[model samples]
Target: MTVQINTDKNVEGHDSMNVYFTEELRTTLARFEDKITRIEVHLRDDNADKSGVEDKRCLIEARPENMQPVAVTNYADTTEKAFHGALDKIKKVLATTFEKQKP
Candidate 1:
């Protein structure tokens, strides 16, 4: 599956970050790789330079083959936390979605 990572101005769009996100998504969504055509991860710093309880946001959109796309968002103090949180939510959503489509 193709994994794309994007970041807002407040977030760093470095090669290391891209590699980290790519690896993380590939590992976390390995099970759904066949069904998923592409995955887009959007990272943003809601409070910019300011710190808050949940200023980091992660939005993940998963495009499933021959099915509607699924999306989930999560907020946390760190990017990794937000990414993991959103990944968990997307996993549950995709599970339930595919389960309902089962014959």
Candidate 2:
């Protein structure tokens, strides 16, 4: 599956982070590799210039091969936390989604 990440101006979005997270995603979502076409990760700072609790936001969208895309969002103090939180949520959602189709 293809994975891409997007970040707003407030987020640093360095190359190292992207590479690490991309690989993590590939590994984490390997089970759905054939059913999913692409995965998009969005990271941003809700507070912009100011620092506050849960200021970091992460949105993860998964596009299934022939179905509507589903997305999940999470917020936390740090970007890593927010991203992982969203990742966890998306995993649950995707699991429940596919499970429903089982006979």
Global lDDT of each model? 0.92, 0.94
6-35, model 2: which lDDT tens digit per residue? 999999999999999899898888898888
Candidate 1 lDDT tens digits, 1-103: 9999999999988999899889988887788889999999999999999999999999999999998888999999999899899989998998898889889
Give the true-structure RMSD of model 1: 1.0
Which clashing pairs does model 2 show?
Answer: none
- After superposing candidate 1, which stretches have Cα over 4 Å from the reference? none
Cand. 2 Cα-lDDT: 0.94
Model 2 TM-score? 0.97
Which sections of candidate 2 miss by over 4 Å? none
Q: Model 2: which ten-residue window has the lowest total lDDT?
A: 93-102
